[model samples]
Target: MEQTQGMADETRHPMTGNRLDAEAEASGPGFETHDYDVVVIGAGGAGLRAAIAAHDAGARVAIVCKSLLGKAHTVMAEGGAAAAMGNLWPDDNWKVHFRDTMRGGKMLNNWRMAQVHAQEAPDRVLELEEWGALFDRTPDGLISQRDFGGHRYARLAHVGDRTGLEMIRTLQQRAVALGIDVFMEFTVTELCKADDRIVGAVGYWRETGRFVVFNAPSVVLATGGIGRSFQVTSNSWEYTGDGHALAMRAGASLINMEFVQFHPTGMVWPMSVRGLLVTESVRGDGGILKNSDGERFMFNYIPDFFKAETADSVEEADGWYEDKKNNRRPPELLPRDEVARAINSEVKAGRGTEHGGVYLDIASRRDPEFIRRRLPSMYHQFKELAGVDITQEAMEIGPTCHYVMGGVEVDPDTQQSSVDGLYAAGEVSGGMHGSNRLGGNSLSDLLVFGRRAGECAAENAAKHSNERAAVPDSTATAAADAALAPFAEEGGENPYTIQKDLQDVMHRLVGIIRKREELVTSLTELEELKARAEHLSVEGNRQYNPGWHLAIDLANMLIVSECVATAALEREESRGGHTREDFPMASDEWAQINLVLTYDGESVGLARQPLPVMPDDLKELFD
Candidate 1:
């Protein structure tokens, strides 16, 4: 791997002028070693932000990612970042945004995190602008705000539909300008620990198959989500629950694992591209959902929870788009969980389109130029991928596995996990979005919490400035053996086959709608898959081998899938993303509880913890 100019040489530890590991040096040609104050994994929007924060805080930071620097899953985030800037509507503020977030999450969110995110998101968005992010501007030259599902106003600050790309570009440029060391094309397989605290990480280079170790006082996990565990997903190959599994194995607890968000509109035609995302921006810009008979089905499915705020008729709903003060929101703008279930119900009742999905039509509502100007990427995505001209015809869409609301449980303020020195942020950390995340809160969550994680990690490292944790030779050797074990097996289960089976189990059993029997069956199937994965074998040497990578990633996928299914089985009530068909309605008791998962080396264990109570002042907003 190439290091930036001015970076410390890898031959010795930066903090101490000594060889990184004496034992490893004696047993030569095994792995390379480096040292840093803070190591951030994933290199997405969150990782970059965390690295920048740590670097600016006078810490030597290194970012290790499975892919190239800027090709993170954040680039695929088409909708904007949610922040209460109030540029479009003067009534919008942090309180309103916080209330909307908590309501959208079905009151199962970490109230403190929700409050902090809302209060800081505006400042974070403004900071991005100051960092050279060119957001779409309003007529008065303010950053443009757009409407999204579950939000009370036009609050998403965007750059057309490619807001995430711009945010990443800005963060990445800032990190590079700060000269933070980046380890590209590196996959971290294990988090090395000493005295039950994070000390370093170990992983292999994708190009040369050589293992490397980073000895650091603090490590930040921004490794996104577990979407790749499912069959139909918007997440990339890198989202194999690396951070979630790593934290779990490192003796940290994960919260709300059952709450997996199925985005309402994914392309559902041409089997090869069935799960590709059709961004929520389509609906934000006046698109509507229709079933086979061309009925606006979202109208019939508006739940009582949002009845007071949602419009009943088409006229009022349509009018609300242009004049927000006088009219209520349309049912189509309900939270993702609500809309996905509605679409699922429609398909089950035989009202679906020819492709077994519903239609998302904007062609009949807006002008072609308006559509192109607003959703340029979507226009091209449909045209190039499905041969469908979105400006002229409707696009078939269905629910696709999107985001996970569950992740490494952390302190809401510091973003520190249960394990000391092991911090998490972005989609990898839990409790920020609660049971369900709104359309655009992810980008903002990454920035706000990523910065917190980095700054806190830097401070944590500073406390141990005189001390350093060495990567124990035994631990590093064990990790290397486990990583290379797949290549040694002969005539064993194919890693690809096991992964496909695992995805099928998760997609069919523990998917958008779940039941007790299906969830239990999924758990049993997972155990069997886990057994098969133990004997997983690959045909290639590890030099840039995708099969070997998948083989290694399968362990993380199984661990995370088991966490999801186990938590889903325990959370009997229907709430947000974790829908239980057996226990159909949302229960007050369940609402008060958050499912937490832990790993004890071999198996995952679950526990129920009470949700943090909201303060009287914040509760007053809801009342």
Candidate 2:
């Protein structure tokens, strides 16, 4: 770990005092204000990386997170970060990674962003290594890469199954060492704009619910996915689409809002941990998917898109695990969208476990020691949560909402959103993954785009710092009033009940398999939810009030759910993560179209835009 800067020399704010855990109470009025060159909202991989990059570029940066540092959602990521280091497969390179990404998204991905991610991911992984991240190593002393869906070869640098933990730790250590100001457990409610440009943000402390202002020329929204909108999800409560809502409300366009990736293997038997993740590493490490009859089911569901590379026969699939050079990759390791659809089909066909899920069996395929060694967290998670030892028995797994493939539309070159001075990265920024994101790519996307977002945000801040030294009090006051509106409502629906109903609506109507009628119904239901949310009333005071927080988060979830439903209704193709049972096949016309959602002051509107054309050199890879 790097040494932390002493308190004597570090930047200090009156609101924070000299201590790290500073607190102030404000119930009715008045709020503290602070200023920074750049404010990064979120403390996950993307936010941490962005803050670190901004600080390193000679900018005063701060990170605002809803949870304590190190407790961000990134720590829950079990599989490795995808980077084409080619340690195991010497022939693998960026072109192959890029090709796989575009193909995995069914060619709906932003070509330039895909190219950039493929080209820059290797260096980002190496940089993490330099910052004291020790990845699994090969016999040759290079970082050992592992197989993952969509990638052509062994190309993920991991630390067992706790790769995200290691990554967040390294980035957190580096950020703390650099003395970047972090307001832990701070939930940003609104992005405050002055002079028609983003100059700061208004949010309340999660501990006290006291509104605070972070004045900066630039803001980076790295707050993650909208998973909590769905009933079954691998997302934490904090993943309620705060960043997406903030950006949309601040006048930025969101792309691909309809595409939500339902990870194939989530714990289903134990009702309490139903949405908990079962890492893709299981399949990458030679696990097989089966139905209740013990039939290898994934083999029968291989789509034509993956037929060339995916093995059809059990012999070839099993052989590929041992010898990748001579045999094809297993169909079980297909991209997340395909695998999830297959699993959903199995369960709906009555070929599922008692809990309405298919079986993920690695126990019968691999030795117990190997299972325990490679997947320690998963081994313990199943053993403790489900009372089933994964080393001895199969895990009952089903699709759960994992990630969003759509978010704030940004320029691929600079990571700048449609709204000036506002930037986004990670799952909050769209166009990289298209209609679906492959496993392992999420981490790499964070690193590659987070760095760019930070660098570009810093440049913008430096250029505009002289003009944006202070945010007007009118803007801050309005933001605070809006945030506290829930407290004023006397009789209204409970925020939690509203949230739960919204989740039910999303899961039932706009789920893994979407239909036009269902999507339309979801949109209408979401409008009703939004109306209820507008008058939501909490029972408790603002001090450490979870009810107030939920009320605020509910508003954001409603906004994001509206985007998902609207975009899903507009796009009529079954492609990648946005599977339309009504339009049950990938359409060439829709392939060329990308849905763009904009908050046009009064209402959110959708527009159809053409996909970015790939350059000849990059397009040659597919040919």
Candidate 3:
């Protein structure tokens, strides 16, 4: 359904109207007034960059995040930022980088945005360098780069493997120094709009259960991805689709929610952290995938898509480590989806090791000193959690849910949603990665588009005048009442039980390998689970009620899942990360369109829209 663009009908009753007239009711309503030129929600890398940009433009900005300043999920990101920095391989350039990104994304990416991202990514990384990000420096003292999957050259600028930590911390400190007021531990539940223009956001202090409204002319959502909705994931708890859900509920069209990327290397054991990522850097540093029989099995799984570049023999694969041009399948690299499927096939074929995982042997493949030097965090995580030495024993590995390539629909140039005042960036704003996302592209996407969203939103906010359309007192009251509804339900349902069921439904049906029948079944179960969530009960006070908090997050997860499953069912072709057994090939028709999603409260459905065509000058470059 094409969402009609205007202020949605006031679903709540009008008898409780006149909240603005009642502003003098409780010592100025006792509701704190924080008027900012721009407010950025979700302080991950994207939010930080957005806040920084808005502040640099002389906007009074405040960043609201649900977690600590630097402890966001970005800190756990290993691997590196993909950029054509030319620190390691001088032959690399933005044109080749853009082409690689488009090809890796299966061409579903917005061509203009992909072109801009590829061009600007290098500069963003260099900006981080100036902000005191001490990336691993090359022998020439330039920021060092490393090899990652799907890139044609060694173009990922990294600092060991904890480059995300470096990036986030550097940005956080800079944001603080710039005097961007940060409201930590607050979760923005809704985007407030007046006369069809987003004017502010309403949230609550998790510590006090008190409602807070951030009335800003501009808002930027950099709230990251929705990986936590799955059973096995490589994201932090904070990644619960807040940005995606809020935007969708605010009437933004979502695109391509079906393409969730499953990373190829997560620890298979230890049920507690089953999906904790073992970075691709491990393979980049000379590790190889081995089956139970100790045979390097990746060579056997290379398909026609990668045959021109994949190595046919162990000697060639090994030789590629020193000289990349001579070898086919570089030992350090294979596209993420290909590698993940290969591992899954091996495990299913009875090639599994003792721990029900394939061997990721770097100990014998590379020198221990080099292994320890490149991947200190991996060494620590393994030693501390699994009690294994990566230098000696091969790390057991399998696939885990990592990222989603689908999100709120936006113009290829502006990053604006169908809604006029709304803009989305980072992982929450999709269409950049079609079926699969390359390892290093995510950080760069956040940086590139976060800046764009801020700029566009700021420009719109500057020209817009606040109409101050009356917000019914009943509306706010009902929202507050609904927020506290779970506490009112007396033992009708358990929050954890509903959440666990939702997770099981999503994981078992919409998992790494998917089919139409399973996806349909999953949707039915999701509907049932959502019904159960309505009456779910919770224990404890509102302050930090983990059970209640999860219940709220479950709604967002269900909505996101609905969009994903619906889009997956409509998209018959197997392209990039979205594979359907029934329609197992990419079609020419699918090549020209994208799956656009919107919800009408009664039901959510898919809409087909034309793909963004490349600019005239860039078309020849791509060809």
Sorted on TM-score, highest at the top, how do the candidates line up? 2, 1, 3
Q: Comparing candidate 2 with candidate 3, which one achieves the higher lDDT?
A: 2
Off by over 4 Å in 1: 1-29, 309-326
For model 1, the local distance difference test gives: 0.90
lDDT of each: 0.90, 0.87, 0.78
* TM accuracy, model 3: 0.92
TM-score to native of every candidate shown = 0.94, 0.94, 0.92
Best by lDDT: 1
Candidate 1 C-alpha lDDT tens digits along 1-623 = 22222335335434322233323323333777888999999899999999999999999999999988899999999889999999999999999999989988999999999999999999999999999999999999999999999998999999888998998899999998998888888899999999988889989777657688889989999999999999999889899999999999999999999999999999998998988999999999989999999888887776766655435334544533322333467678889999999999999999999988999999998999999999999999999999999999999999999999999999999999999899999999999888899999999999999999999999999998898877888898889899989888999999899989999999899999999889889999999999999998888666668999999999999999999999999998999998988899999888899999999988999999999988898899976
Against the correct fold, how does model 1 do in TM-score?
0.94
Candidates 1 and 2: which is better by lDDT?
1
Task: For candidate 2, report its TM-score.
Answer: 0.94
Q: Backbone clashes in each candidate structure, one number apiece?
A: 0, 0, 3
Clashing pairs in 1: none
Any idea how many clashes model 1 has? 0
lDDT tens string, model 2, 1-623? 11122424334335444222223332254566787999999999999999999998899999998888899999999889888888888888899899889988889999999999999999999999999998989999999888888777889899999999999999999999999988887888888786678989888767656667788999999999999999999998789999999999998889999999999999997789998999999999989889999888777776655554435334544533322333477778878988899889988899999999989999988999999999999999999988999899999999999999999999998999988899999999999998889889999999999999999999999999668756677777888788888878999889989988998999999999889898889888888887777788887666678888998888888888899999989988898889888899888788899999988654679999999888899888877
